[model samples]
Target: MIVKTSRPAARLAALVLPLAALAGMGTAAQADDWTPTSAIEFIAPANPGGGWDTLVRTTSRVIQEEGLADQNFAAINVPGGGGAVAWAQIARDTGNPHKLFATSPPIILVPLAGTSQYDHTNFTPIARLITDYSIVLVPRDSEYQDLNDLFDAIRENASLSVGGGSAPGSMDHISIAGVASAAGLEAADVNYIAFSGGGEAMTNLMGGHVEAVITGAGEAAGQLGPDSEVRALGVSAPERLGGPLADIPTYQEQGIDYTFDIWRGVMGTPDMPEEAVAYYEELFAQMLETDGWADARDQLGWIDAYQNSEEFGAFLDEQKEEFSEVLSELGLIR
Candidate 1:
C-alpha cells in the first residue's frame, strides 16, 4: 500500500532545506572569507604596564582607530605562568577564529625552562610585528665602564647578580645567560634576579638593590633620555639602534659576538580558521602602514621586522631549537 505524507511533514522538510542552505552559506563564508563580524580579542598575556601589555594595547588601539577592523579590538590581560595561562586558553579555543594572543620569546622560553605548561605548537602564528633587542644597562656613574668591564667583573665573580625585568626563568634571565655564556662564563654560574618590569628594576638599581640590568632596549632607552640618570652599556643587536639610543654601542662591537632580537608577534588558537588568520595578517599589515604604528615602534625603539605566518612558523621553530640548547646549557632543562 502507498502512504501519503502530511502537510506538517512537508513544511518541516521545507524548513530543513533552508536551514541546510544557510549552514552551507555559513561554512562557505568561514572558509577563505576575510570578513570580520566581531571585534578580535587581543590577549596580552601579561599584566598591564608591561612590555607585552603595552605592545598589544598599542596595536589594538591603532587597529580600532584606523578602522582596520569591522569593530574595535579589545585587549584582555591573562598574566601568569609567564604567559602559560593565555597560551592554554588560546590553545583550547581552536578554530575560534576571533581570538589572538600577543607573544614573544618569553612564550617559548617559559615552556622550555619547564616553568610553563603551554608550548609553541599549541597555537598558530599570525604575524611577527617587530623586533625588540636586549640591552645591558648600568647606573650613570658606575665604575663599570663598558661591556668589557662588566664581563671582567662577571669573570671575577660569577655571582655578580644581574637583575632583569622578567621573572627568573623568563626571557630576561635567558638573555643574561646567553650573554654570560658568550662572555666565557657558564650559564649556571650567572646570578639573575627578577624584577616585574624595567622601571622597577631601574629603581632597584638606583637603590643599590642590583648591580646591573639586562633588560629590553625599549625599557633602557628612557634611561638615556634627557634628564635621565642611567646609561645603556650595550645593545644585543647586529648593529647600533637609531634615534636617542643610536650612539649606544653593540655587544659585538665591544668584542662580544652575540645578539638577541625578541620578535613580538600575534598568535591564534590551534586550528583557527584560515580566513581569520589571513584577515588578521592583512589588518595588521594595514595597521603597520599607519603613522600610529610607526610612532609606536619608534617610541618603543623597536626594529620593524614584519613577517607572515610561514616565515614566523619557521622562525619559531628555529628559536625553539636554539633555546632548547641554551636552556640545556643553563641547566634549566636537560
Candidate 2:
C-alpha cells in the first residue's frame, strides 16, 4: 500500500524561500554569543561503525583536535527504527542548544514512507557536511561482470533479490531503483532485501544469499580488495572517484544516466534558538576548513559539500520533493 501524489513546483519553491531567508539573516557576532558552556551531546542516530556514527565521531574528533570548540563534544549512539528512535528523542528535547544529531537521506525518505512520525521538517537544520555515493556490488566469483550484466539478470527474473542496509524505501534501495528505472526496467519489479546495516548486507552477499548489494561507496571500499570475495559493479556518482575507488566506473560512464549521493549533516532539535543555530553553523563551517577535517574526509571517501543552516534547509526541501517523485515512481509512496 504505497502512497502517491503529485507535488507542484510551487510547493517546493514556497518551502525554499523562507529557508533561504532564514539562512541569510544569521550573523557571526550573534553566533559568538551562544557558545556551549558544557559538553555538547553529539547524537549519532545509528549504531557505532555505521555512516551516522562515523560522521559525528569523526567531526567531533576533528573539532577537538583542531581546537575549534571550547567545550568537549560527546557522541552518543541512539540506534533503532533506522533513526526514528533517535529523532523522537531529539524532538522531545526541542530548543536544547547543546544537543545535535548526524542526519542524512533517511531523514527525508523514511518519514515519507510513513514508517516514522517525524521528518526533516521536525528538526532545525544546522549544516550539511559531506556526501558519499553508492556502489553496486556482486560476489567476486559471480558471472556478472558489470552493472548491465546484473540488471539484465534482474530484468529477466524479477525475483532476483538485491540487498541493502536500510529499509525498502530508503537510501540503498532508492539508489538501485533510480538506476533500474533509468535502465528501462519497472522499478518495483526488482526485489530488494533490507538488512539492518551495510555490514550485514555484505555478509549476505558473501554468503550468496542475495544476487547484488547497493551500499555506500566507503562501506564497499572497506570490503573490497585484490583477493576479496566481492567486486563493485558500478557506483552512483556522475563521475569516477579517485584513490581506492578510482577504478570503479560511474553508472553514466557505463551508459546509464543515474546518480545518487548520500549527503550527511548535523541537525539540532526543533525550536532551537536562532543564536544556537548560528553558533553550530559557524562551528561546522570552520570545522570544514581544518586540515584534520580534510584528512577525515579523504579517509572516509567523502566529498566536501558544506552548506550552512539555511542552505541545508533549502536543500532538504528539494531533496524531499525529489525523493517523493522517485519513491512514487517505485510505488513506495502512498
Candidate 3:
C-alpha cells in the first residue's frame, strides 16, 4: 500500500535565525544574515527509498555539504495520498518559517484528482530542481519486442496487468492508462497494482507478479544496469534520453503520442516568513551548483531542469490544468 500522513514531529528542535543571507528580490531585512540556525525539516510525502524521499535526502546532503545553511538539516517521511499529507502540512504551516516541503508533478495531480484537500495556490513555490522522464519496463526475457509489442498485447487482452509506484489516480497509474487509451484500449480495462515505492514495485515486476511496470527512468536505471536484461521499451519524453539509458526510444518514436515529465521541486507554506522562503530558495540554488548534486543526478539518471519560485509556480499552474484534463478524460477525475 502507498501509505502517507501529514503529522509533523511532536517536538521541534528550535526556532532559530542565522546571519549571512543570499541575494534575491525580497525585503532588505529578509536578506540580512539569512541563515537557519535550527535543524531544517524537509518532509518527503512518501515512504523512505521512494523517488520523493531519495530526491529530498540527496538534496539535503548537497545543501549541508555546501554550507548552504548554517546548521544541520533533517528530513522526515510523511507518505500518503500521493503526497497529500506532506502538502497539507506545508500549506498549514503558513506561520512556520523553518519548514520546506518537497514537490513534483504529482503535487499538482493530487489536488486535481480531488485526493488532496488543498490546491497549488495554497503553497509558496520555492524552487524547481529536476525533471524526470517516465519509462516502460519489462522482465529480461519477456516476449514483447518494444513499446508497440507491449501495447499490442494490452490491446489484444485488455485485462493485461500493469504496475506502478503511485496510487490509483496518480501519475504512475495515469501514464499506463494514458498510453492504453491512446492505443484503443479502455483505461479501466487495464489492471494496475500500486506499490508504496519504486523499490517495492520493481521487486514485484522482477518476481513476475505483474506483466509490466511504468516508472520514472531515474528509478528504473538501478534495475536496468548493464548486467541486467531488463529493457526500457519507451521513455515518456518528446525524444530519446541521453545517457547510459540513451539507447531507449521514446513512446513518440514508437508512434504513440504520449509524454509524462516528472518535475521535482520545493514548496513552503502560503504565508511562510519571507526571510524563511528566501533562505530555502537560496539553499536550493546553491545545491544545484554542487558536484554532489551532479553525482546524485547521474546516479539516479535524472535530467537537469531548474527553475526559481516565479518560474516554477507558473509551470505548476500549467501542469495542473494539463494533467487534470488528461485525468478527467480517463474518468479518474469528475
TM-score, candidate number 3: 0.85
Judged by lDDT relative to the true structure, which candidate is superior, 1 or 3? Answer: 1
**Which regions of candidate 1 fall more than 4 Å away from where they truly are?**
1-34, 197-200
- TM-score between model 1 and native: 0.83
lDDT of 2 by residue, 1-334 (tens): 9965457867888889998887766654456577888899999876665778778889999999999989988999887777888989999997899999999999999898887899999999999999999999999889999988988999788889999877778887788888988888888878999876676787889898999988888656766779888899999988988767888999998889989999999999998999888889999999999899887787668999999999999999999999998888789985
Candidate 2 or 1, higher lDDT: 2
Who wins the TM-score comparison? 2
Worst 10 residues of 1 by lDDT: 218-227
Question: Which ten-residue region of model 3 has the weakest summed lDDT?
Answer: 10-19
Error of model 1, residue 21, in angstroms: 16
In candidate 1 the C-alpha lDDT for residue 117 amounts to 76
Write the residue-wise lDDT of candidate 3 on 99-203 in tens digits.
Answer: 777777777777777778887788888889888888889998999878778878877886677888777788888888888777667888778888876766778
Local accuracy of candidate 1 as per-residue lDDT tens digits, 1-334? 9999999999999999999999999987776577767777888776665567777888988887777777767888887666776787788787887788888888788887776778778888899998889988888888898888987887788767888767667798888788777877777777888765555566778888788988778646655875777878889989988877898899899888788887788888897777777877887888889988888788778877888987898999999998888777678773
Off by over 4 Å in 3: 1-27
The lDDT for every candidate, in the order shown, is: 0.80, 0.87, 0.79
**Most lDDT-accurate candidate:** 2
Lowest lDDT 10-mer window, candidate 2? 24-33
